[model samples]
Target chain A: MHLAEGVLPVEWAAVWFAPAAATTVIGVRKLRSKTTQIPQRKALTGIMGASVFAISLMPIPVPVAGSVSHPCGTPLAAIVLGPFVSVVVAAVSLLFQALFFAHGGLSTWGANIVSEGVAGSLVGAGVFLGSRRLGLSLFASGFLAGFIGDLSVYAVTALELSLGLFGVSELGRQWVSLFGAFLPVQGPLALGRRCSPVGS
Target chain B: MSLRRIATVLVFVAVVAAAVTPTALHRGKGAGDYVGIDESIMEARAQEAGREARPPFINTDQGDLLLFVFTVGGLLAGGALGYLGRMVFVEGATSRERTRSMVDGR
Candidate 1:
């Protein structure tokens, strides 16, 4: 769900900064549980960021659209690094994508970061934690976590595109009138935990 | 053409190609709307609402399934990376010790 440049614009994106900044703080603070040093943490961050880009490179064909949705790599980053570091991983990877792939634009970086970063957190905390608590296998937990992460981002993407400044087209104004209507369809897919096998 | 001129021409071509590619793809879908929604919106809504009242199509079922698959694949790939990183770290640790011992003539 790479937002095209000026989709939501910089002023709107600025609102995302507070959440991302808070996530970063929580991430660094949570490192107390690990024996790893700052250098190692930095290294993990870089590696996870690269993995996000690399995974997206392996295209998944979406035959209906004739264009595939590239992997967001959010859940992967969360699993590799702690869920908290996912915010950092997403923010960094989106930054890189903005510059290199022109996937997301400078003006929309913060918005992309928040939407993606939050998705990673949802999977990391919700599916992973909840399933594991219920004694689900690591593989199942991981699968569910990732499923939630991807759907959450898609819902967010649909929300921002359908209702945000870019808005539904004037021709489709009647449908746009029901902007909030899709929430029911979108929300459960975004949050529901579908059962997956022990290992994906 | 001089190298600089050739480079300029190539850059221009690249930019134009990039711009037109998405347009070409969008037209293929029979979707003219600027906000890029996939075909499902049309399939689900077209007949019921007719073309005039078409909303952005979201095939939540297929979309969710595709999304889950992407995540599963991404996670496995990330775990592999994490595994390799740990291996490289271990190798680096030992290699560093070996170099230290060599320089000291131990």
Candidate 2:
């Protein structure tokens, strides 16, 4: 769900930027406070950041979509670190990808972060916490968190594209199409992600 | 075990099998079948919306650059994980031991 450069209009990009920046600031502060409380978490955070970076960069093939797609590793990070800190991890990873690999664009960085970082982390963590509260075991909760959160990233990206690029009149149809484009490819990858949180 | 636990295990195994079975069953398929959807689908849709992907500030799409970047990223990730493995894993175990000792003393 890395929206490439020039994909989202300037106004829409800035609209996404506000929340992304806000979350990032809060995430950084939360991470710093946590590190002060538990020094070991600082190193763990770095390792998780690097893991998210490398894991998302790998493109896996899906015969159903007849194409390859990457898995969002934010869920695992969120599961390990807190969700807010996971946002920072994702932002760092997305920024690196944008700068070095040209995978995502600087212009669309806000949108990408909003989709992958904010949406993925919060939803993944929320689902995991919710499942646990409902008395589910660790493994089951992790699997639900990873799978559902992974799918939600694409869903938000599709919504962003529909709102920014396409006409409102055709919004529903375009959103579904864009979301569907990723569904088949992402489903199996999401299944794969189910193991990431628990096995890590 | 309860039927629910057994079912969960079965589903987990099935998912794992589903992920791996395809590659094992269809070895040596055409390379075009594996093109990334980011390029094939996302980019195409963006074009249809009248927006084109511009060249990035540092375009690693050039020869060998992306590969080099991936190699560096992999090394950094591996090194960071290796260096912190003891702190993250061993420390957790040590903490667990400390808690167990405290509880036993109590």
Residue A149 in model 2: lDDT: 85
Q: List each candidate's DockQ score.
A: 0.04, 0.40
Q: What's the lDDT for all of these models?
A: 0.54, 0.82
Encode model 1's per-residue lDDT on A1-200: one tens digit a residue.
Answer: 56655454345557656776788677666654442554465555666666766554344443323433445567767776777777766776676556544356566666677667766555655767786787666665676666667656655655554444433463255334322333222222222222322111
lDDT digits (tens) for residues A75-103 of candidate 2: 78898998889989999999999999878
Error (Å) of candidate 2 at residue A12 is 1.1
In model 2, what are the clashing residue pairs, if there are any?
none
Evaluated at residue A51, the lDDT of candidate 1 is: 74
Q: Judged by TM-score, which candidate is best?
A: 2
Runs in model 2 with CA error above 4 Å? Answer: A196-200, B1-32, B91-106
Candidate 2 clash figure, as a count = 0
* Native-referenced Cα lDDT, model 2: 0.82
Residue A2 lDDT (model 1): 63
